[model samples]
Target chain A: MGAHSLLPFTQDRDTAGFFEAAAEGRLVFKACLDCGHALHPPTDHCPRCGGWNTAWKDAKGTGRLHTWTTVMHQIHPDFPAPYTLVVVELDETPEVRLMGRLQGEPELREGMPMEVWFEPLGEGGPVLPQWKPVEA
Target chain B: MTATVIDDELAFAGRDKAAVVGIGQTAFSRDSGRSVLSLATEASLKAIADAGLTVDDIDGIVRCEQDNVRPYSLAAAIGAKNLHYWADTGPGGVAPCMMMGLAMGAVMTGQAKAVLAFRSLNGRSEMRLGGTGRHDAIEVVGGFGSYDEFYLPYGLQSAGQTFALMARRHMLEYGTTAEQLGAVAMACREHANQTPHAQMNGRPMSMDDYLASRMISTPLRMFDFCLESDGACAVVITSAERAKDLAKPPVLIRAVAGGAPQDHRPGMMFPVVSREDMTELGGRQAGAELWRRAGVGPEEMDLAQIYDCFTISVILQLEAYGFCGKGEGGPFAASGALRKGGQLPINTGGGHMSEGYVHGMNHIVQAVRQLRGEADMQIPDAELCMCTGGPLPIGSSVVFRKAA
Candidate 1:
């Protein structure tokens, strides 16, 4: 089963760009262009500065692992057991955090360098962003 | 962040104004094989009867948010003449205890003479909250708008994974161990062994058994999660003046307070990933205020019946409620202090982890039982108890005392 059947993706103005960029192997984030305050999940107004002048900026697709869990129980029909879910803090700002599947060993430690990559959304569906260990 | 010390004068406004005169519950099982409405009606009737009152005396009804059991249907079944005050509070686990505050407000304001606060869920037969196939996530209507987009995609669906993430962070920060989590499970199991109504009654748990349990999520094993019980619980809240003539001795509502983190938003607890300190829970945010309002500190509480949807919740509550300092929860839990006759007995009625999940309504029942000197594992001279609801970024808590 592909994610297209199980989960819905954003096509709206707020999140379409982030998903569209992910579809094209580019990672982007939302922020208040005025105060340079980073935002996540994209909103209409800046929570920090109350500015509606939000901007979608390119992200480096790299961050440090903050925390993660290895799910051993089957939590979804499309996704089987034993997948690593990670919460990563972007290298640019600690406030800008992202979460996704970690694509390697079940083992995890805090503060490990990680980089973002794209993967087909569950058996050749829409492309989605994933995290992996950054090699030396 | 500094904790808010509630203003003493303002905090005592609700003290001794209302009291819980009756507690009632249905059989906790994997399958109730009954409609949620029926369960709710049965529990409400029992609570009313326990308070030595009839449907006509029940002038108000309070429900937990998202409950399939509606006040209108419950009123119809109970033949309530007038529901002067009817309300619900949410998002689930935290709302049960908070319901008391609502009921108290209704009674104190003369909106109603007696209020029935209850929760009923066919958690195992009709639904499973801890499992993957939550209907709410699939329906995607109501309040779960953008919040679902963030965490549900990565197969991080269940409460186990979400709470495990919190446990993992606590472990990293305080060097907490899985064994400490095991101690919480073992303590509850020990209490369950004595609790006749406990779902896990007669079953014993050991440190080795806990460690051997299958890992549902990295840090949380199957034993760490609370049971998905098919049951209902209800309590009757009335003025202390009325409670003097009731069937059971009144368990005075010392105080009831609730709140969320500063940045808390509805649907924000899915992963709790963004906060700088994930260990800081909404319970901590509400704790200081709760105690100040109750006019009692943690030292005076004879026991605590914390919401134990997960073992980590009880641990987190201990730290947040000022029973122990931050980062000291693991050591405190593992120290045998929570066992009966220990320094601070907790979950003496087995809690949700062992007794049953009434969405925390059972915690209130257990608190009343303990204070009345009626619990199976009753602590001698137990006159004060604390009941907490959910350990999320936003939660509720109550302090109860034996009638003075």
Candidate 2:
């Protein structure tokens, strides 16, 4: 029998505002009032300080890909194989690393320089933030 | 004090020493039609009833959704009250004990009266019904693809694939064999057969069954992996002083700690295991710290509830925790010295593969049972039981002693 270890599916979350911001080419992060740790995956409250006081801050839009994966299989049927998912460690905040995809043909060597970009996705309301290798 | 608080307002007191007063679980099955919410409800109520407490008595809740259950919603379903602490930690098994450690901190600092750490999963029922990890053409560019993108392209996608790579490396370096891997599974089956609630209860396997199981990923046959079941598990942590008056013997939280190796982040085809080095640095590091803090070593503990997401993981953890020397995990496991009534008696409740999978929470609950003298395959006078959280990009461990 072939391997049947497939991952369960999850519904998409709306990020229309994220798309709106991405269309303008401004990267974002959430800053906690209590600890000042810039949240990589934006959240409403500070996990360390228990403080909900947070706001979106503009990122420098430059970072190195901390790690990347090359997909040979897709958990969902629609996704094509050989996709690169990457986590970019932003230079602006040492602790914040956001996940996105590399736009061009992907080579997943860790620590490659990356620049953020946006791709219009599902319903075209949210311009999903994507990344690409820095051309030397 | 079983009333649990599960409102939208998220809050948690930092780590504390809270004792477990209740324990509950739903039947472990692969195709149960229950939603994540329902399984959580079943386990939560059973646990509360077991604790001899009512749901209305709980004041804080920490949700460890074993890959599916939503914390906020499950909290609501259980009618959790006061609801101060809530987080849907990783799908790793080490979470429940981590919660207990935090509860102890809260109790010591006087932040709350009691906290319920609950984990629920409905991947089989919910997804098999209609919803599964959506990786369709439209969804694949994000989320599910997030971690997969690194390896799937290079042919390293599934957990079996990743673990197999590790196992292969271990085999090459330690001269381990497929039969030794079978020993780990065989041992867990022995324990599962004894525990009625275990997913593979009463099912017997030999080297043949283990070796015959079709390969899911190279070097990791199907039997080498964990079973996916729809269920929930919970452990209530209060105070040992107060726990003495409760329904069951209190299992003292000796010490609990969590950490990831420096190579934890974005680990994949690039490092840590990129080359198949099976020795886990994180497991070893956590073991040293846990032993030091608990004032004990592997020999002091009567038994262990090591995380067995994969048979190789158990072997690695055994060595890391000083059960034996590096690369000696194969012979160490082969000694048949780890089965019931054996010197170490690891995974007395089966492990993730044989016990129902609730991340690793069942392992924690099993350790509690060992200390409480309630284990189905109770080890003789099991006074100290150590539990490990499943690997993460991070990991954790806790040593539990039957409260005197």
Candidate 3:
């Protein structure tokens, strides 16, 4: 961790479960109860079927890199320069993607297999999902 | 799924019914050393004068929601007695053509005879959009939840970074070279070299310069980002009948459409990562409707003022507007087709990349100038110009044609 803290995360009714599950090292997403559609970054209702009822589903923690960027300039004090960010398509739901910081220097390729690891933001900080190449 | 369902009757209602009679803009600069209201007032008065009308003749005002100046403040400054209609539209860079679209609706509906649509901001000195000055965090629980929650923690803060991901994906999928992206920056810079008022006019950029420029985000260089400037731009809109007697020839508002993709996430760039195809933009559906309502295709356009908040934006819009096919924007840009005297010359006034970032307002002003045959890098006999708002998920576009 750097000297600066991560930006504060605010949990609402729709996202409280997501952060709560992260504390237990289990990645979770909201799935529509009616249509079984998965919502990333979770929503109150299903966009496809207009279903209000939803349930939290655990993710497999494995995904493929859809796209990535190595941020060269520092936009925030908390995030120092020369860090890489990746958007990963979950193995269970390819369409449901999540963004996170990529760990270790790896020659990244699209569709490369990766696994998620949780990083505790020091004391009282929110747990964040991070990505790294799957070990051979 | 199409983001917008066009009403057959309403879609065609404003086509050729309203016209842009005047265009005005303040000098593009890193800092204006003046209030936004003063900038708005100067541009609004200039636009009114350019239309061959006095301030009293203006009965309506339309503005971007993000603009620091408000309609009432502008009206008071301009000395307009009574306003018949007033409205604002936004998300900043996406609202120029949409603002004009609203003005067209107000005029066609008889809500106002002459409406002034304007955007004014001290983007550089005050609220630098591409920088961290604006407090990039969001309050998630207070009924104002946004997609920022996902990316802000990981340092994916600026719009440039979000767009960089899209640019990188395009390169991966299509073998788009850095030179191809350089082509867009160079083309806009060349146009700026011709445009006396462009902020980058004296400073020409070469491909080597573009390549050598330090990277802000992986594939996106400093040159790839748009200039953050302090400026204001305004246009006067009126009924087609009234346009005939104006000081300048009328540029008919052929068509206007604004919409987002079906999976468009609420908060601009952050949610875009979750979109199915990162290479695609809202321009796909919006462009289809634009051409449909105008009864014209991309081939009919004399030029395009595609919003260039970044070099990639122009590339995406080129593909979105059907100037070329999908996954072909890189090669299309590299073909030297966007420069003056080439096929589909774009941003003849230098655009956001070279001219200034007035949140796409300058693009509209440039389109009007090209159609009027008054652009510094004018395309000879330019009759039709297409100005697109955001290449973002939620965006708008308009087709302007010189009245026959």
Q: TM-score of B chain for each model? A: 0.95, 0.88, 0.96
Q: What is the C-alpha lDDT of each candidate?
A: 0.83, 0.67, 0.86
lDDT of 3 by residue, B1-404 (tens): 24756579887888899999988889989999999999999999899999999888899999988888889999998899978799989777788889888899888888999999999999998888886674434322222366565677777778899899999999898988889888998889999999999999999888889999998888899999999999999999999999999899999999998768757765656778888888878888788888999999999898999899888888888988899998899899999999998898988878899999999999999999989899898899999999999777586899999999
User: Per-candidate TM vs. native?
Assistant: 0.93, 0.71, 0.96
Which residue ranges in model 1 land beyond 4 Å of their true spot?
A1-4, A11-17, A46-52, A103-105, A122-126, B1-10, B134-146, B262-266
- Off by more than 4 A, model 2: A1-136, B1-17, B65-72, B127-134, B138-147, B267-271, B274-278
How high is the TM-score of chain A in each model? 0.87, 0.74, 0.91
Off by over 4 Å in 3: A4-6, A103-106, B1-7, B134-143
- Per-residue error at A25 for model 1, in Å? 3.2
Angstrom error of the Cα, residue B372, model 1: value is 1.4
Residue-pair clash count for candidate 1: 0
Give the local distance difference test score of model 3. 0.86
lDDT of 2: 0.67
CAPRI classification of candidate 2: incorrect
DockQ in order: 0.45, 0.06, 0.54
B-chain TM-score, candidate 3: 0.96
Q: In candidate 1, which residue pairs get closer than 3 Å at backbone N, Cα or C atoms, i.e. clash?
A: none
TM-score of candidate 2 to 2 decimals: 0.71
Give lDDT tens digits, candidate 2, residues A1-136. 1121222122223222333466677777667877896653345566567788977778878887654444443443434443545656777776666556443235455567888876544342344456677888
